[model samples]
Target: MAVAYDLEGQKRAYKRWAPYYDRVYHKLLADAHAKTARAAAKAGPDILEIGVGTGLVLPWYPEGTRVIGVDLSFHMLERARDKMLSGAAPQTRLVAAMDACRLGLADESFDAVAVPFVITLVPDPEGALDEAMRVLKPGGAIVISSKLGYDTGAMAKIEEWVAPLMKKVGWSSAFRIERIKAWAEARGDVELTEIAPLFPAGWFKLMRLVKRS
Candidate 1:
């Protein structure tokens, strides 16, 4: 049996993937991430983007939002940091190479947390979400843009078969939407704010959960 999620494996994988990531993943990702970024900007002027790969979402953030983006991949984070230094990410407060499951930020410090196509990619999705909630201020928001694990689409079966290969590309197909909901519900500290389908690909969704007051 293969390990479902290995943080070190993902780190090594992303390191090998960083150079061509923007061209390949960016092209296929299209505007799915942009939509989430826009929503995140509106929800927060102090945002923490969990997987700010290559600073792709940085360009879309509002000018006033202070985005603190983190990624475990040093190679990927280097690109994000470069964008911030070059003024490509004008509102980026900082871009650090850090783990999602174990963040070093102060509790209740961020107004919102953004995880774009990233939760399922981590070793512990629940832990990652917990950490997101950890640093987020009460009433803060969380935005997620990614392909869910639910079997709603016609390609679900086919996707499942190819999931093993996809894992090498830095994502797990085993993550369920219900898992995300359950995490929030278990904490009793968040409300489902949005669960809209992302267009062009119905397999994906844009979700928002607001921390309770």
Candidate 2:
């Protein structure tokens, strides 16, 4: 399996992908984006979206919502900034270039943290999740939409085989859901509130974790 995490590689990959990211993923991930937005909105008004590439989920957030987005790729944020400036997603107050594993944000600040199709792409997913949980307020939630790999099966084998190739493009194909589950269990500060499979035969998933007060 591909376990190496190259920050520079990710940056380079996304820089190349930013220009046409929406054209490639907008429709494919529309449902998941909408669902993620709704889940975050339901949690509360103060929302932070991690790896908010191209701001595809921005317009989906309800009117009057406070949305802040962050990504490691300046190129991707440029596109997202353009979308924000177009007034397509007026709810978005800010979009900045920030590292997922080292967010320059306050602790226990946001009511909800949304990570869409980003966990597996993160260089250090556990560290990123730690940051997400740190920024999340008690009683708030961390919502995620991602393509999770199988833990054991022929599909898992295939994912392992393809992981290295996928890494060059900016994400891991063998990132398992069990890793997230283990993170939640280890934290003991959050609980699994929801885990629903998304399109393309359950390859994608929408998961939520509520922080305990």
Q: Choose the strongest candidate by TM-score.
A: 2
TM-score against truth, every candidate: 0.87, 0.88
lDDT values of the candidates? 0.83, 0.89
lDDT string, candidate 2, 1-213, tens digits: 555768789899999998899998899888889999999999899999999989999999998689999998899999999989999999999999899888999999999999999888677888899999999999999999997877889878877887787678555656777899999999898999888978755557889999999
In model 1, what lDDT does residue 114 have?
93
lDDT of 1 by residue, 65-181 (tens): 888999988899999988999998898989888888889999999888999988767777878888999999988889999877665665667668777887896666677778888
Candidate 1, position 162, lDDT: 73
- Model 2 — which ten-residue stretch has the worst lDDT? 166-175
Q: Candidate 2, residue 86: CA error in Å?
A: 0.6
Q: Cα lDDT for residue 27, model 1? A: 57
